[model samples]
Target: MQNIQHPMFALSLIFSFILVTHAFLYFISSLFSNSNYWFYFLAQECILFISAFILPNGSPTVLIGLLPVLIAQSIIILKNKLKVILFFMLSYGLYCIAITINYGASELPIFIPIFFLILLIVIVYTISYNRQVSARERMEFYLQQLELAYQKVEELTLSNERQRMARDLHDTLAQGLAGLIMQLEAVNVHIKNGNISRSNEIIVSSMQQARETLKDARTVIDNLRTETLEYMDFHSAVLDEIKKFEEITGIDVEQEIKPIHSLSNLSMEYGIYIIRESLTNIMKHSQARKVKIKIEQKDGKIYMEVSDNGIGFSIKNIGKQTGKFGLLGLQERIRLVGGGLTIESMPGKGTKLFITVPI
Candidate 1:
């Protein structure tokens, strides 16, 4: 191993010397056409090279012999004080190698081996440092991507939950309330015709339904409080909200909710708000006779569809209306939850709202 290393070391030293000499000569030649600095630099390099050759290889010398050479190189390569300091430090490493080579040497016999080892160490260190830096940068980049993905997931989850809540209010509690209201009105008519017993029974039933509605409302509030805006069960909550919507709208709002769970509460709330706003817009703008809401969860995502067979307005004009907060608010709410809200409508045609949230 020493034999192989020895020859390689000799060759490397020869090559390095040749390169440095050529560079110095090139600078000297260019000096006449360029600047005096080049001449000074070339002179320093020549003096260093001659001194290294003349110095006895086994001589116990400090870094004094090599220090001037390094300082000269630094003056040429580095301008700013900080950069000069760095280059000086880097160049000083070579002095340490020289010192180690000369340490305990009876003669110059060990110079070749020491030079070879130093070169090898430098090359290996440079490669290893570069690889480590590259790896760290890559890891940081992937970490950022992961954070972004998590944020998007959280937002989508919240929006879906909101949509679910709105649908529930519109479909379940809302419908039940509307029924109770109708029954009461009917009983009122009956009382006018002297059907006192029938009127009393109807009134009692309506009261019961009212109590149930109040309970459901309380449930909604309680669930919202227990779970933060990010981690709520959207499916059941949305169903309840849809029930309420039906009761208030006096419209037959049909729903088909699929069995899906584990959505962020923020997403759910945003979704519910979007649905409520859409329905409100329908009530105010569309004179449709029937409304339908469909919700589906599949492929790690939630989808909602609300359609009304009402007198639809121009899609362009919908945004232009001064009192169009329902439409604008729904859009903004969905966006915040990392979901999308799209409206499809034309004059005299029914309107359809499609909302999608990533699970």
Candidate 2:
């Protein structure tokens, strides 16, 4: 290769090469991942080698153009401070030898490049150190945020479990005790009227109810201890409720449940309770003969409609005092999982409930 001995031409060539190298570095960063930085380091090393041979007319001034390359490598390519220092020292030493061979060692002004090299090394090292510290701080901040999020999740889980326990107790133990009290009152009335056979029947039924209540309480405790209760499928669970309601009330139920995606256990639990609650209210209050229930998944939501052709009451009369685990409880359950409920009812007209829950 022919050496370009002109001073200005060589300086321009060196700078042009520097600018192109920077463009390649930017292009590579855009196209590839950080792991390929070694490519840039090797390229810089090759350019540094060629710069020595291209010392224009035996002048070392052209080597100044390489400061940006050295700065970039120090900041990005080298991870260790000692290695950066050693590499910069060796590169400057090579430049020194190139000039010394042309102008004897005594004639060269050694302090100029040496001065800039020291200054740049200090600046590059400081910048690298700051970046490392900044990165560590950012990592710690993210870790703290993650820990707080985990704690919030734990608290929410505990709250939901507490609510589940309360609902179970209200449905089984509390309601069972209330029923026993009413039955005992009936037994007292029968005994006072000298109806011995009727009193005996009431006593027997109350005993059976007490046993069932005890069994349910034990099951609740067992579930709490296990904490591994598998979720029942929503379709099957709702069907079981419908069957039980039909057997007890002899009300005709029409069900249309689409093939739904499997929902989360939490959603399934809440949904089943909502359905059961709605059915219980119907049997106790609505003197209806036919009921329709439609459940489907649409638009990233679970939609449930329960309509009864019964003597419906006014929605305005519904209040917080609508018995234990009434509409209020049902609404609370839906709200816990970011859901909405709409009730349409009128005296002597049919009642319809439109419920929606996010999946």
Candidate 3:
């Protein structure tokens, strides 16, 4: 206490306070702001020795404050447990040695050892608390991620179920309903023409169709269902389809499209339908030698056109064709997704489809 009152001890206190403040702040900077702290700690430790030796007379006041600050600093900045332990031990040893030399070892207070033991307890408790907090936070984060992954898997399962139901309905019930309606329609036409025998025949055929529809529906439900197709990139799938068409029909296809890697899954699905429908129609009705396909994005929308150089038919009679379902369905799908489809054709000319769909 007398040494602390001396002018030289006051100077030593100022230097030690400034150095500790800087090191502690830099150590804080490293923890909260991700900065370098080891250099500051090293420099502070060297200066700390200087300050400790300057107070040759026992100054328990400085050691009491400085020891705790060193422990706190080591805890905040040091990553290695061994280094933290060694730093505390070495600092405490130096403090005891300085105090013992200044005050005769025989005159040291009995409670001084007890005071040091309490500090060691606090340091140990602090390290244990820090590790527990870190482990708990990590466990919470892992649980959150697991919950998210479970939700995604559940969503995928529901989506798959819906797709399967849709395919079953479309393949069996839908086709049966279409045949029954067409039969009923034909029966009406025949009854008006006073042909009773033909009308009865259509009614009998309609009943047969209903039975077949039931069997098909059961077959689809009983069998193990799988995905319609494996997932593939839209552009690559389109290219494969075109190549297959060329191989089958001997018709050369001229494709002109920009990079389509950014198209959404829904957009790509519709694109596939449009391509297949347009190409099938060309193969069926158009006696064309060459066909052109183009796709691009413009005005924040997707534009697609399929054209063929062949003898085109009258658009008005398209409805009369029994297989006009494909083209009509294509148009409906495109329109439902905020898109428009236009057909251009005339007798002895080419047919072209202009389409616009939002992104």
Candidate 4:
């Protein structure tokens, strides 16, 4: 309806480029390093304020366009709702001031609707972005907890092994050596007293005991060097877990495994752990009568799904469910091996777990 070339439109073009370019560069650089976004924010507001005077009233609203950019910038750094609202109000105030100075108080009526429209966009975007950020933060917190739990599990395993070794050594090698020494001392006493037959008998008895102790030591060493699932890969491991789970719980399990032969040891370990934990949760929390498990390898990734027909709960209330699936260590476990996990469920509905990991 209105098309007149103005200085303001040309000036606003520069403002748009700077704002978009800075945001792009900031996003990319942020992946490598933190940036001083404050400078970008100040520069944008300054440019938009300047454009209001050079451009005619009929030109595009350069000042109003800057509103969303400001909110986007704030979302990256600030989480406090009050702080976001304050920044929004402050920027809007400065914009209103610029308009008042450039166009006069009587022109306010023309800008009111656009101001409310921008506010709606900012509010909706802020709330949505805030929810996404909160979800990510919670996932991160769960990963940290999983890491800590893994460390504790490893430490406890090592400590337990050391204690077992110590106990075995005392019971086997140490006792054998002490008994040999006592028997030799007795033989010496008998030999000194000229009792050759008694000395020979004692020597033969000590030889037999030494052989038994050596056998016990070898058995312990073998156990220490091997794990229960050392040779089997991830796919077999999941089936094994399901087999055990069904046997113990009396709940029939349905499993589909596409053997993942190329999985790294780390990936397999994490996969088995996830299956184990999932089964544990099922046994403990889910009052389900049946379970289904699926595993497959596709496109250089391992995918797993475990579902059960149990009374389920809301994913929205995950934070409140202290010992539930999402809040627990499965996400963290899957995450450590450079993978992701997703769960779907609802009230009176079954829960399904989807797992993906690089092979």
Number of the candidate with higher TM-score, 3 or 4: 4
For all candidates in order, the CA lDDT equals 0.65, 0.74, 0.72, 0.73
lDDT: which candidate is best? 2
RMSD of each: 15.4, 9.3, 13.8, 15.5
- Candidate 2 wrongly placed segments (more than 4 Å): 1-240, 243-252, 259-263
Query: TM-scores for all candidates?
Result: 0.39, 0.53, 0.43, 0.54
Q: How good is model 3 by TM-score?
A: 0.43
Model 2 Cα lDDT, one tens digit per residue, 1-359: 22434346665687568657755765665454467655555566566556556543434544555544565455555667776676667666766666666566874576455647765776777687779988999999999999888767855775678678868967888889999999999999999999999999999999999999998986576445313324446777788779989998998799999866757666766777788889988988888999999999999899999999889877777774547327887888899999999999988998999999887
TM-score top scorer: 4
When summed lDDT is taken over every stretch of 10 residues in candidate 2, the lowest stretch is 222-231
For model 1, the local distance difference test gives: 0.65
Give, for candidate 1, the lowest lDDT window spanning 10 residues.
54-63
Error of 1 at 54 (Å): 57
In angstroms, the error of model 2 at 246 is 4.3
What is candidate 3's CA lDDT for residue 317? 76
Candidate number that wins on TM-score, 1 or 2: 2
Better of 2 and 3 by lDDT: 2
